[model samples]
Each structure stands twice: as C-alpha cells, then as structure tokens.
Target: MSTLTPGEQAVMSRFDLGWPESDIAADLSISFARTRAIISTFDSNPAHDRHREAQIRRGSQRLLARLRKAGGHR
Candidate 1:
C-alpha cells in the first residue's frame, strides 16, 4: 500500500537507481527545491523497503539473464 503519488513514485524510483537530485529534477522538469523537499520527506516503511529490495533483485536477475543470452558475461 503506497501512500506516495505517481510523481513521487517516479522521483523515488529514479533516486533508487542512483540518480542525483539535480538530474531527477531536470528529467522530471520539477524545481530542485521541490525535489529536495520530496526526498527530505521520504518515509521509511518496512514494507516499502522490502518491496524495493525485491524489485532490485528481480531486475538484477533479468539483467544477468539478458547478458548471458547476449554472451556479454565472462
């Protein structure tokens, strides 16, 4: 159960992907202050943390599979 709005989710997703706040703000076309404010207020829910961890694991697995298929792995 996410309490964040769609825009917030997008911001957080990019943030999780290691994007800088400036980059996120520029990409999203939002003000830097707004981006900082949103990030500052990010809540730490255990469920959300677990969900994000699972998503990262799944993405890593898929990337590894694609690399293997493309002979990109050593």
Candidate 2:
C-alpha cells in the first residue's frame, strides 16, 4: 500500500497508540472538539480499517510467537 497522508497517518497512529484526544489535538495544533471529529472520521474510514487490521494481525502473530517460545498452547 501507498504511504498515508500526514493527517491520515497522524490520526490513525495516535488513535492506534491509544492517545487521548486532547493530546492529539495539542500535538496537531487543533482544537479539542475538532480532534474529536477527526477521531470519529478515523473510526469509520476504510483506509484506516486496513491499517487497523494489519496491526491486529501483527499483534496476534507476536503473541503466538511469545506463547510458542514459552511452550504454551491454545
């Protein structure tokens, strides 16, 4: 996939990293309410959905690897 736009990447990464809306707003030099709306947009976007799914897959793979290293099974 192509690289994300600065705004798209920032919003997605901030939300993915579990940042507070206020922090995202302050960092992006935007207002708190505008940040909230941006978060809402990110939540419903298909492009962001693809990023979220990739993250989930990577996380699950890492968890499985760690479990395997510990000789654990599901």
The numbered model that scores best in TM-score is 1
Which stretches of model 1 miss by more than 4 angstroms? Answer: 43-74
- What lDDT tens digits, residue by residue, belong to model 2 across residues 5-39? 78767876897888998898889887888777666
**Which residue pairs clash within candidate 1?**
none
lDDT of 1 at 62: 99
Per-model TM against the reference: 0.54, 0.47
Encode model 1's per-residue lDDT on 20-54: one tens digit a residue.
Answer: 99999999999999987776557365776787789
Provide the clashing-pair count of each candidate structure: 0, 0
- Worst 10 contiguous positions by lDDT, candidate 1: 39-48
* Native RMSD of candidate 2 (Å): 10.7
